[model samples]
Target: MRLAAYGLALIAGLAVTGAPNPAPQVTLDRAEAAPGEQVQVRLTGWPTGTVVIELCGSGGPARCARDTSAQIHVPGGGAGGAPLTVSVPPGGCPCQLRVSTLDTRFSVDVPLLVSGAAPPDSGTVRQAATGPPVVVGASVERDRGWPARFGAPARRTVVLRLRNEQAAPAAVALSFRVGRAPSPTGFVAPPAVPDLAPGEERVIRIPVTLPALALGSYEIHGEIVTAGTAHLVVVTTDHHPWGLAGLLALAALTLLPTRRPRRSIGRR
Candidate 1:
């Protein structure tokens, strides 16, 4: 009788543990792309049991790996978004993207267009030059942290102040460069107007954010472009962490400026 009871208990435990749970399904919601332009692909409605996901072309045999496969996790009934930056391969063609769940065999297809270059945004901001001696503020590293105030999980707003000491109103363009990659061209923040009346001063404050920012020393600088002169100035001083992972992330940011470093004479 004791042997039979132990056998029955073992059978019950195995039956309960062997049940299959529904896996999280991954679907490619939509592709917002520009021909010859790198775009972010977003996914939605993911279920559980998906350890890995991959993208394959329906028309072509090319495949794009998940930027950070484990970065975004989905168990059952969870949703997530992944930012994929891929240069649309040459030519005008329709690319079908199939997103698959490695374990559950769940997937979806998204159609994307590889078209011409993206249109430029003609937004401009100007700042005037002023002063006998324009005194620039110096940046000192804080004792608390490398980027104590500017580190990761930061607020979206970046506040900066510019002083123009000249008597004539100057149209200055506010520009930013992280490492060596220049900020997106054609997107200029409105400038701070400084009083150019010799002793008069002006303060300009601008706020902006970079998508998917990584760890590094991010320098916010400005260039005052006039008829025949250009003044480049570094404004803020904030140092983020520089670990192995940060080095890798900065490597990615550096590549962003490669294709659009300067306008191509051939494209124009």
Candidate 2:
């Protein structure tokens, strides 16, 4: 009887104190996906704010290859949380999708399997005939249409031009790389393009962000069907003179003494 009374008291105390809730959890709509397929992700118990999501490979020397990883921002709040969509690129592999707060104080990793057979080529060649039916072009542009500055984020665009040389529509796989790294975002799995008619040319654009902190020489390479590769070189340097000066000024102000000013006594 005494033990039972103690148990009741403990339960009452817990109810009054309100136990802390469990950490955030993540769930996927499906366990596996094919190349170029989209997967739905759901997050629960996430705090109210912005969260970062990253998809990274699981094995091999290139386990966390930039091309295999993509970053996304999620606005999380409430019990329902938020829903996100991620694309699976070609080549089967065990991958992990991680979601976390900006500071990374709280996070969760969910395993995902990406598997699928490659699409067969139709054998339709382009009339331009230089080579493959697909051509890739890439360029880097800074945000706000400004030139690529040293300490500012830049936008990279990979454009794929498809030409239907055969009488019927043709299907092909496209991939891109930046400075020996796979395009950080899955550029291989873009939206399905409508069949192109004979002599039809279609252009598709894939964009990725290069953070402001990045510096040094980098190259962007785009390929179609392992042929018709295009390359672009980008050189970034530290060019934020104004920012550095401002930081120095702020530091100097902080070090100044905070004593109250002395009053003038001549008038009195």
- Best-performing candidate as measured by lDDT: 2
lDDT (Cα, tens digit) per residue for candidate 1, span 105-131? 465656665445333223332333432
What candidate 1 gets wrong by more than 4 Å, as runs, is 1-135, 138-167, 179-188, 192-195, 235-268
Q: Indicate the TM-score of model 2.
A: 0.37
TM-score per candidate, in order? 0.28, 0.37
Give candidate 2 regions above 4 Å deviation. 59-92, 117-268
Give one digit per residue, the lDDT tens place, for model 2 in 1-268. Answer: 9999999999999999897876789888888766556567677777753444545443321122234333333334424333334444222245666676534567788887756523323333222222246443334443443433434555665555666676543433234444424333222223333335567788877665555645544455444431122223232212233454566789999999999989978965
What's the distance in Å from true for residue 145, model 2? Answer: 19
The model with the greatest TM-score is 2
